[model samples]
Target: MRTQSVLVYDGDCAFCTTCVNFAERRLRPRCESTPWQFADLAALGVTQQRAEYEVLWVTPAGRVHGGAQGVAKLLLSAGKGWAVLGALLTVPPVRWVARGVYRLVADHRDRMPGGTPACALPAHLRPSAESPATAD
Candidate 1:
């Protein structure tokens, strides 16, 4: 069997969580799912600050994927119909299109569900003075 990868995503973002939940239901039987957290990201060699700025995925081969590419990879690994989607996403033009869409969604995420400042950083877990600001 192919080695499964670790998916890293924002646990607080409702939209993100919803999508992950869907993926989990469809992919869980095949792969591993891991919530994106400061410690887990750090251990994966990805800075918490970086992960906070975007979604990430760590392939079993130690390769890292982010954004639409990450999602495509996850679906592809999930087996069945998504596998075809993943394969198609790897094509040059399709890959470009996929990334572009991912960028649009990510850029406008603040307007999407579970995108409020409170959701991004709940009062109880606000960033400390030492934490790095969001990446540009």
Candidate 2:
């Protein structure tokens, strides 16, 4: 059985890898970060499509939070100023805005520093093309 939460990200994206590295070095979030391509998605109860779409936080109990919520959960686990920020991100209006901001950044990640064209989500995997429930 799992103990710590697993942070699943797109390892194929250099920008994503860079962000994860920064989080590890600076934020020190309490989780094991792994690229989805290298993870056992089935064991983590994550789908390939979903993993490809956004960052994922998979709790030991099997709860899966994606995108901005995933980021919030990661921060919450950090247990400090980051936890405070994570709490703020979960507030109704703040959560909504964070979701939008996360999407905006994710949509343009391919243009971000260290990012490559491979960082862009495929058409079928885009949020507009596939809903969360159907992503799997």
Candidate 3:
């Protein structure tokens, strides 16, 4: 088993990097946060395509959580007040809403503060349940 969980994200996206920086600075979650470009996805049991599409939380045991679920896992590891918010996020009904919120934020990230056009995934790279993040 791996010794630590890893948080993987898109370093190329300014918005994404800023968010990660905020999480690291403020949330202080106890995990190794790395840009997917620098991570060994195969070793983390994460696929390059999936890493390109969404943020990921790769557990020490090799289980992978994506998008909003991954954020919840990250929060859970942060301890104290963060764990409470994380627990709330995992509640079934709340999780569904969180997923939608995450998707919306992802879709418009290019327009967010600190973001560049590079932060927006082309429609072709958007997430879908059937094929992960494949386009229509």
Candidate 4:
């Protein structure tokens, strides 16, 4: 059985919403997938600006994932055919490719659904306010 997992997505992006909606419908019964708005993330302790930038997933282990890894983790947790895709994406060569692809998608998100010219976060999401480093 799958433990509780949370997928933090950009609720404002149409493409993201479409993909998340598809995941919600397809991954139901095996996992729980929900749309998370910027406000929702801020309420969860993620900054509004941070949440607007990348896709986040809170794993069953309570660890957070971002970027391509986050998307693969979500697919892994979802089970079904996606599990295979996740595995493939996690492979060394594929992982590199996946990261590149993720960057492209993220960079061009403005053309996607729910995307706005000002949707990107000014800074990377920090685990804590005091943390100096950031992840992209």
Q: Which lDDT values do the candidates have, in the order given?
A: 0.70, 0.90, 0.87, 0.67
**Pairing residues by index, what is the TM-score of model 1?**
0.75
C-alpha RMSD (angstroms) for model 1: 5.4
- Evaluated against the true structure, the overall lDDT of model 2 is 0.90
Q: What order do candidates take by TM-score, descending?
A: 2, 3, 1, 4
How large is the C-alpha RMSD of every model relative to the true structure?
5.4, 6.6, 6.8, 7.9
Q: Least lDDT summed over 10 consecutive residues: which range in candidate 3?
A: 123-132
1-136 per-residue lDDT for model 4 (tens digits)? 2277677877655667777787777765244555564335544445555456677776556566777887888888778888899888889999999999998988887676766554443333322223454433
TM-score between candidate 4 and the true structure: 0.69
Error of 2 at 67 (Å): 0.2
- What is the overall TM-score of model 3 with all chains considered together? 0.86
Off by over 4 Å in 2: 121-136
TM-score of 2: 0.87
Please give the clash total of every predicted structure, in order: 0, 0, 0, 6
lDDT of 4: 0.67
Residue 47 in candidate 2, Cα distance off native in Å: 0.6
